[model samples]
Target chain A: MKLTILGCYAATPRSFTNPTSQVLEVKNHLFLIDCGEGTQMQLRRNKIKFSKIRHIFISHLHGDHFYGLVGLISTFRLLNREKELHVYGPKGIKEIITLQLKLANSWTNFPLLFHELNSKEPQLLFEDSAVMVKTIPLKHRIYTNGFLFQEKPGERKLLINEAVKYNIDVSLYNSLKKGKDVVSEDGELIENHLVTADPPPPKSYAFCSDTVFDPDIVPQIKHVNALYHESTFLESEMDLAFPTKHSTAKQAATIAKLASVKKLILGHYSTRYTDINLFRQEAETIFPNVDLADDGAEIIVE
Target chain B: MKLTILGCYAATPRSFTNPTSQVLEVKNHLFLIDCGEGTQMQLRRNKIKFSKIRHIFISHLHGDHFYGLVGLISTFRLLNREKELHVYGPKGIKEIITLQLKLANSWTNFPLLFHELNSKEPQLLFEDSAVMVKTIPLKHRIYTNGFLFQEKPGERKLLINEAVKYNIDVSLYNSLKKGKDVVSEDGELIENHLVTADPPPPKSYAFCSDTVFDPDIVPQIKHVNALYHESTFLESEMDLAFPTKHSTAKQAATIAKLASVKKLILGHYSTRYTDINLFRQEAETIFPNVDLADDGAEIIVE
Candidate 1:
């Protein structure tokens, strides 16, 4: 799994800093998360193909989180896109986009489907043969949700040399990979474990942002390969975090430690803080494996 | 009068090129004309004082013309603005903006007044003691209106040296500045023309964009100091201009020449053309005093 940070700042977008948005690539699917203003330009700046974005997920109704959505959709129509596009977001998202399209008299030629989300529980949002996505309900000033992307377990790896030693026919390799025993030509029974080794472990990534310090969500995102959490403030500004329903770097690190995530990626830094290294410093003090999220930064899940 | 081109390209915004937007500063009023997407950042990049912009004029409901408006308004609220903001646009603009604000539950703290226009004839949009704004009706794919900014004639020059030579009392100088004949202390009639020459001719700027080759607006913007007209295509693509309701560079020059504008500024170039100089070459063939509009290009009306 690979994730690209298109924008990581909070609130209004500035000349150098953008609001919240990112592109997550997992199992050959490119999912756009929280399209802030100027996201299309950011996508172009990063050289990400716009057609690769099939699904868009919005966390809330705030302007910083989803203001760029209508413009992007309009551009798709202008480009004469033919592929179907799916959007998942809060309940009012569909109305907001459709109204603007209606006003401009520029409806999309392609199938634009919207799945309005109002669930307060951890519900399965999307699933396919290779991957599954679930919503992690978050505590914020508004109705918000973070996403958890998990890759399904793969089939067992075939051991060709071991299969040859057992004199197993090539046609039976498929059954062996499925963890089934195959009879040999000399009337000897061969165990599947002797010919096939276990496949690599599955990996998952959890994205949490614009939320307060809520350990209750730790159970839902527990043991993920990587966790991206919002660090809008430093430890010194802890006093303002709860009032604004935002998380400090130390609070995000605490959640990562509790969930036992392999790595913690800190993002959504407040524009007030010029130096982002301060967030990593505060987060690392609580969780040793911490990385700062910057625009155009790509993190590969290991 | 000074005009700043925040964005000059047509249609969708790109990584390097922006859509249609400009700032016309007339008589101390910073009038924002057509706020396209990413305009707030453009304003910051141009070093414009956001607080000074009390009025915004949107040409049409097209996303490229007004998509950045809501975000800018929301940013004002975030900045805790206390001054009232006035927005003038097409009839449905108010509903489009109010709906989004309602959905987000983020009502502005400052008063936001909307002036919706659905007139086919030129109408007065705004006026003050020093300046007046009138709509320039244009033919397009949709209902659209360009703006005409006119500086009201100022008080006649005092001609202090001539006034003193005429033995005019210092207290009566105000009457002379107002072009009023003053009575000398010995009951002698002092001619107004002798003390003051005509105030500098009133300067006007007409902004016409996203319109077809319609000369009907020539009368409204006739003989203006500066005229900005959209030239979305070149003569080679003249066939596409009418169908798209846009003008060619040569067609825009024809309009400028017919209107007898002192200087013609061409903008809203199609993104397909990489070199903008071609537009100037094509326009200057018919109008010698033609200038090309670019992002951050400032043009002062003399």
Candidate 2:
């Protein structure tokens, strides 16, 4: 799995720093997350193919989180895109987008689907043979959700030499890979574990942002391979974070530590701070495996 | 009057080229015209003060023309702008803006006034002691209007030497500047023309865009100092221009010639043609005084 941060700053997009947006590539799916203003330009700058974005996930209704969505939809129409697009966002997302398109009198030529999520509990959003996506409810000023993407475990590996030694027929290879015992040609039973090896463990990624320090979500995102959490303010501004329902670096680190995530990625830094390294330093005090999310930075999950 | 082209391309904003947006500064008023996507970045890049903008004029409801407006409004709120903002656009603009704000639950602290324009004829949109703005109806696929900004005539410059020779009292200088013949203290009538010259001809700028080859608006923008007309296609694509309700360079120049404007500025070029010089060449064929509108290019009305 690969993750690319198109923008990570907070509130508004600056000339150099963008707002919140990212691209996650997992299991043949390119998912766009939190398309803030200027996200289309950021996508182009990052060299991400526009046509590859089949699904979009908006965490909340904040302007900095989803303002670029309508523009992207319009651009798709202008580019004559024909592929169906799916958008998973808050309840009012469909209304906002439809109103703009109605006013402009330019509707999409392709199918535009909306999945309005308003569940308070973790709910499955999408599932396929290769991957599954679920929502992690978060505490914020508004109704928001974090998405968890998990790759499904593959079939067990086949040991051809062990299967041949057991005199197992080649036609039984599929059964062995499915972790089933195969009957030998001499009517003897062979255990599947003796012929096949276990597959590698599946990896998962969790995206959480624009939320306060909430331990309630820890159970939902536990043991994810990588976690992206918003650190809108520093520890010095903890008081401000409470009122705004945003998280500080230390708060995000605490959550990561509680969830026991393999790696913690911090972003959504307030524009007031000129130095971003402070966030990493503060997060490392509690969680050693912490990385700062920067625009165009790519991370690979092993 | 100063005109700054923040962006002047047709349709979607590219990595390098922006969409349609500009700043017209007249009589101490900074008016934003057609704020396309990524206009705020352009404003920052051009060093244009955000606070100086009080009025925004949107020609139409096309995404490329007004998609950046809500983002700018949100940014203003984030910046804690206390000044009132006025937006002029098509009838459905208020609903579109209010819906987004309602969805985000972020209402502006300052007043946001909307002037919805649905008239099919010329109408006054804004006016003050120093400047006047009126809408010029245009022919397009959607309801559209081009704005004509005219500077009111300023006080005539006083010829101090001539005033002294005429023995005009200093207290009556203000009256003379208003083009009134002053009565001297000795009961002598002082001629205003002999002591003062007529104020420099009031400069006007007409912005007509996203329109087809229609001569009906010529009289409304006639004799303006500068005319910015959309030339989305070249003469080679005249066939395509008609159906799209867009104009070719030659058609824009034809309108400029009919209107007898001092200079013609051609913009809103389709991204298909890379050579922008071709637009100027084609426009200058019919109108000798033609200028091309490029991003960050500034024009002074003399």
lDDT score, candidate 2, position B122: 89
Per-residue lDDT of B221-263 in model 1, one digit per residue for the tens?
Answer: 8999999999999999999999999999999999999999999
Model 2, position B167: C-alpha lDDT score: 84
Candidate number with greatest TM-score: 1
Off by over 4 Å in 1: A184-187
lDDT of each: 0.92, 0.93
Query: What's chain A's TM-score in each predicted model?
Result: 0.97, 0.96
C-alpha RMSD of each candidate structure in angstroms? 1.4, 1.6
Return model 2's CA RMSD, one decimal: 1.6
TM-scores of all models?
0.97, 0.97
Task: Tell me the tens digit of each residue's lDDT in model 1 across A1-302.
Answer: 88999999998888877888999998889999999988888888989998878999999888999988998999888888999999999998999899888878779999999999999998888999889988999999889999999999978899899899899989999998788999987789999899999988999999998899999999989999999999999989989899999999999999999999999999999898989999999998899999888988999987
> Clashing pairs in model 1?
none
- Model 1: DockQ score: 0.77
Residue-level lDDT of model 2, residues A16-87, one tens digit each, is 788899999998999998899888988888889988889999999998899899999999998899999999
